[model samples]
Target chain A: MLLEVYAQTELRSRSQQHGGIAACLSLVLLLLVVSPSLAFAQDQAVAIHLIDMAQDSELSITAASLADGWYDESEDSRVSGYELSDGTPVKFADWYHTDWPDTRVDLLTQFGDDFGLLWGFSTGERGEKYTIDPSLRVGFVAQAHPAANSILSLTVRAVAWGNLNEQTCEGDYGEIGGVQTVNCRLAATFLPPEETLQYLAHAEPNRLHISLSYSASF
Target chain B: MTLRLKYLVTAAVAALALLGGASSSIAQTTSPVLRSWMSPDIADAWTQGYKGQKTTITIVDDFTSSSKFTGNLGTGSLLYRHGEWTRLEASMIAPLATIKSQSFYSGTTVPLAAGLNVLNLSYGMYARGTYSLSQLGWSAQESSIINYAKNGRAVIVKAAGNDGIAIGSVNAAGNKDFLNLALVGAPSALFVGALTRNGTVANPASLASYSNKAGTNTAVQSHFLVVGVESSKTGLAGTSFAAPIISGYASILGSKFTTATPTQITNQLLNTARKDTLLNYNAATYGMGEASLSRALAPLTIR
Candidate 1:
C-alpha cells in the first residue's frame, strides 16, 4: 500500500511542475507582446500649449512746457505702458520697434505646435506721426479618455491678421494769393490695426473626433 | 623628208583620237555625280525583275482599298495619279500592292512567300481602354500574323499617323468613342514617322506637320521608325509617303539579299541611317533618324 501511495505522489508532483512551467512561459509571452505596444504608446504622446500675453494696458507721457525751439514731436510724445499677462511694462516707442507691441502670440511647450507661425507687415506715413501695430494669436482644444491612448483635438488657430498697411495722407482747405484767400488744415496720424477675424473656419471638424496618433515612448 | 614628217603628224593625230575615244568612254561609264545622284545600273537591275522578290507584309489600318487611293494600286501610276510626283525618279522604286483591309477586324491573313514583300499601311487607330490584343478578341489574329512574320513571311510596315500628338495620347471622346484602332504596345509592329529631305531635325518638312512623335514610353515610343516621304512637291514629307518609301526600300533590300529576315533588314536600315544629322540617337520626332536607302543597300550591292 505504501509503494502505491508513493507512486501516485510522484505522478502528481510531475504534473504540477509541468503546469508551472507552462504558466511561466505564457506569462513571458504576454509580456513580450505587450511591451512593444507600451513603448509605442509612450512615443506617440505629444504635449502642445498656446501662450496668450494680451492684457489691458495704458501709457502716460509728460513733457516740460517749453517755448518753440524746434521741439522734437517724437521725443515729446514718448510714453510707457505695461502688459497684464506677463506684467512686463515697456515704453510705447520701444515696444513699437520691438516684437512686444505685435499682437502675435507664441506657442510654449517642449514639443512644437502642429500649426506653423505666420506674420504680416505694412507701412504708411500720415501727416507726421508714424504708427505700427503687430499681433500674434494661437489656440487649441483637445479631448482625451482614460480607456484610449490618444488625444483628439480640433485646433482652430489664427496666427496673424490680413490687409495690414501703413500710409501718409494730408487734408487742407486753402486758397493762396487769390482775390479771396482762406487757409485751414487738419492732419492726424493713423495706424490701422490688421483685420484678424478673417481666419475663422466656415466649417468644423468631424463629429467622431477620433484620431489614432502613434508614437514611440523612448 | 616632207612625206615622212606628214606621216608622223598623221600618226600622232590618230593616236590622239584613240586616247580621246578611251577618255570619253570612261567618262560616260563612270561619274561620281551620276553614281551618287542615281545609278542607272541599279535602275536597270530594278526594271529587269530586280525589284523586291516575292515577300509578304501586313498593313494594320482602316479603309485600305485599291479603288479608294490610287497609291493602293501598287503600280508606278499611283504616283502620277495622286500627283505624288511626275515620274518614277528611280526604277527600283515602285509600290507593289498585295492586300488591303477595311478595318482592324478585316479577317484577312497575309501570305508569307519565300522572298521579300512590303506592306504599306497609312492609317492607325489609337488603342484605349481594355481593348488589348487579347481582350479585343484579336489574340488569334495577332498570333497568326506574328507567326507569319516570325516564319519569314513578310516585312510588315505601318505609317505613323499625322496626329502631331505623342502616341497613346488619344483618349475616348465625351461619348466614349475610340479614335484609333492601332495597337499601341504590340511588339511585332513597326511604326514609321515622317521626316523632310532638308535633313533638319525637328523642322517640319513640306509634308503635313501632323505626323506623330514617338515617345520613350513603353507603348507609344518602342515601335517607331522614321522614313522620308514626299511632303511638298520638292520631295518627301508625310508619314503617308514615308511608309511607302520604307516599303520600297525593304523590297529592294529583299531582292538583293535573299537571306535577310524582315527584322534584320529593319535593323540594317536603322543602323545605316545618318545619326549625326538627327537631333538625338532616337528622337520622339524622328525615330532612328531619316531612312538612308543608299546606306541600307550598300552591303547588298555588288561592287
Candidate 2:
C-alpha cells in the first residue's frame, strides 16, 4: 500500500513538472513573436519625440531687417522661422537688392525627423536701363542623422533675364541689346545647432555657404 | 506541439517580410541619363520630318567617298544627287560616282535639272588675283556650269578653298593660274566658309588652319556664307565640320519648301540671321549671322 501511494506521488510530480515546462516554452515563443513589433513601435515613437524636440528648440530672426541694393550693392539678408500645421518647421531667408526688394524670397520646409524641401526666388534691376529679371528654384533637404539638426540639400534652379539697357559714355557707347538667357544652379544649406545659436547671432551671418551648383540638371 | 508549430510559422513569416522589404529598397534606386551636344531632343526633330524635302543639291569635290558621304546625308534626309565632275587631280577619286575624263563636256552643256537643287562643291582650285568676274577665265567647262546656274537649273554651292590665306590673295607658287577662280567673281556660286563650334570664324581656312578666308575686298565678301560644323569630337573646332551642318540645314529647307527657289532659300537664311556684336550691316566675319531653322521656315505671304 505504501509503494502504491509513493507511485501516485511520483506520477503527480512528473505531470506538474511537464505542465510547467510547456507553459515556459509557450511564453518564450510568444516573446519571440512580439519582440520585433515592439522594437519597431519604440523606434517610431522615439523618432516622433525627437522631431518635436527639434521644432521647439529656438528661432532666429536676424534676416528681417536688411534693405535691397543695386547690382553692385552690399549684403542683403533676412531670416524668419515658424512651426507648420503638420508639426514641421518652416524657415525663410530673404535677399534684398536695391533693384527689387519685395520680389526676392527663399523658403525652407522641414518635416518630422529628417526630410524637407526648400525654394527661392529673386528679381532685380540689372543696369542703367535693363531689369535683371525674376528667377525661381526648388530643392530637397534631408537630415543626415536622427538628431535632425544638420541637413543636406540638393537644389535645381532656372534663371532668366530680359530688357537689358545699354549705356552710352566716353568711348563706351555701344548698343546693348535685350537678351533672354536661362541658367540653372544646385545648392545646400546647414542649420545651426541649438548650442551655437548665440554664436550665429553674434557672428557675421555665414552667407558664404559652400555648395556645388551645376548649370543643368541633366 | 501546437504552440511549437505556431512559433515556427511566425518566425518564418518575419524572416520573409524582412527579405521582401530589403529587396524593395534596392529596387527604388535608378540610373541617371547622360547629356551630349547631339542630345536626343535635337535628334528627335529630324525623325519628325523636319528635314526639307524635294530640294536638290549638287556637290563638287575631289575624291568624295559617295558611300561615306551619302551615309552622312542619309542622317539628315537624302536631298541631293551626284553630277558630272571636272577632275583637277589625277589622284582624285569619286567614291559614289562613275568618273569621266575632264575634257568631254562643253561649257554650254546644262548640268542642272530645274526646280530647287543645291550644288555642294567640297573642292576648290586656286586662281589668284583680285576677285573680278572678267579676271576668271571662262572655259567651256566653267561657262556651261555658270549658264545652268543662271537659268536656275541649279543653285551652285561651292566650298571656299581650305588654303587659309585671305580670298583674292595671290598664291606665292607659280601654280596660281591652275586654281579654279569661280568663287572670286561668280555671282551664281555661293562661297561657304567654315565656323568653329563656338560660332567664331576659323582662321587660315585650310586643313590645320589651311582654309581660305573671305576678303574684305568686294568680290570675296559678295558670295560667302558661314556655317558651323563638328570638328573635334571632344572639342568641336573646325569649319569643314561646319559645312556639313549648313548642308544639313539646306537639305531640310529644300525638303520642307519645294516651291522656294535656291535664291529664295538663300534670302530667307540671310534675312533671319540674329545680329551679332559687330553690328555692321553685313560683317565679313558672319555673313547674315548664324543660320536659324525656325526663322527660315516661317510661313510665306504673297507680296
Candidate 3:
C-alpha cells in the first residue's frame, strides 16, 4: 500500500494537473512522514475541494463616481451607498454574494484519507481586470456499505456555502437544446466590490451560505 | 338638555372636523415629487406651497421640430429629447408651473411668450466635451437665445454641455463668444453643470464625471453651477439634465416673486446657493453652488 501511494503521487506530480491538487497532495504526504504509525493504522477516504468564490457584483458606488473620487464613507464623501433599487441605504459589508447564485467548483475530488483545504488558483498570470478569489469548502459526510460487497462504498454528503443576504430575487428563464431552463435572478444587481477580499469576509445577514447534497461513489 | 342646544353643539363639532380635514388636504398638495438629483431645499419649498405656480417656464432648446410642431415625440428626439426631459424634471419640482416648449430654427423666428420668467436651454453649440470660446462663436440661433435672456422678465438656465472638458479661456483676439455673453455678461443667464447624484453638495465627488467644469479665471467660476443628473432611466448623464434642476428652482422662486424680474430671480438663486455644503468649494467648480429653492424663496431658513 505504501509503494502504491508513492507511484501514484509520482505520476500525479508528472501529469499536467499540477498546482491546486499537487499542493493538497504534498500536505498529506507531509502528515504521513510526521506520524508514520497513524497512516498505517486505518483505511480512510478523504475529499479535497478547490473552491472559486462566486463572481461577486461590483460595489454599489456608481462607475462615474469612482472615475472621479473614491467613496470614502469615513470622511462622509459618498456618492452612493449599497441600497435597494428603490434607494434605501444598506451597509456595504452586507452586500457580498448578493447577486451571484452559486460557487463554481474549480476542483473537487477525494484523495486517500480525508478531505483537505482549498487554496488559490495560480495556474496562469493574469492582468488587472481578472480577479482571483478562492475558498475552502468543509462539510459533513456519511458513508454506507452493503454486506455482500463491503468494499464497494458510497457516501451521502451535505454542504453549506455563504451567499447573498437580502437580494431582491426574481425568476429568469432561457432555452437550451430545445428545452427551457429556469433560474433565480436579481431584480437589480450591483457592481463588483472595489476590493477582492470583500467577497469572502462579508456574509449575507440571517442566512448561512448555500447548502448542497452530493452522493459519493468510492 | 333642550333639543335646540343638542343640535347646536353637534353642528359646532362637525364644522371643526371639516377645518381639520381641509388643513391636511393642503399639506398633501404641497408635497412635490422630488427626484434623487434635487437638493433638500426643493422639498422645503414645496412644503411652503411653492410648486412654480403662476410661473411659466419656456423650454428654448431644439425640440427636433425646427420645421414643424411635435406634440411629445419629434424627429430630432435626441436633440428634442432634452427639451422633453427638461419639462419632465420641471414638472416634478414644480407641478403647478405652466411649461411652454419652443424648438430652435436657423432663419425662422419663435416668439418668447408674455410673463415667461424661466427659460430652460438644455442644448448648446458643439463644444466636443471641451470648453472653448471659439466653439460658441456668434450665430443666428445664439443671438435669439441672447436676446431672450437679455429680456429682463426671463432668466435662461443653460446647460454647460457634456464634454467634461473645462470651459477654456477666450482667444488672444478677446472675441466675446455666445457662451461668454450668456454666462458672464447677462444677469438673467445661468449655466449649469451636472452632478452624479444629489442629496449633498459638499462632496466635490458628487460632480458627474461627464459634466463640464469651468476653467480657472473664467466666467464659469461665478456663472456655472452643478446639480445631480438622473442617469437611471436614460443611461445617460450630462449638463443637460442639470440645467432643468436649476430651471425648476427658478420656477419655484418665481411663484414667490410674482413682481420680480428675471434678473432678480436669477440673482436670488445665485446669491442664496449653498456654498458651505461643498468640499474645497470654489466658484469655478460650484458656481455660486447648487441652487437652494428654500434659500431662494426665503433668505433666512425658519428652522
Put down candidate 1 lDDT per residue, A67-151, tens digits, no spaces: 1112223234222321211112222233223212212223422222232222222121111122323333343433333344433
True contacts kept of each: 0.00, 0.00, 0.00
Task: Give the docking tier of candidate 1.
Answer: incorrect
lDDT (10s digit) by residue, model 2, range B57-131:
444432222311121211222222122111211011111112232211122333554445555544333332433
Tell me which of candidates 1 and 3 scores higher on TM-score.
3
Number of clashes in model 3?
Answer: 17
lDDT for model 2: 0.33
Ranking of predictions according to lDDT: 3, 1, 2
In lDDT terms, which candidate is top?
3
Q: How high is the CA lDDT of each candidate model? A: 0.36, 0.33, 0.45
lDDT string for model 1 (B22-70, tens) is 1000000011111222222234323223454344443443332221222
Query: Which stretches of model 3 miss by more than 4 angstroms?
Result: A1-218, B1-32, B65-80, B127-141, B168-183, B199-205, B232-234, B300-303
Each model's Cα RMSD: 35.9, 31.1, 21.8
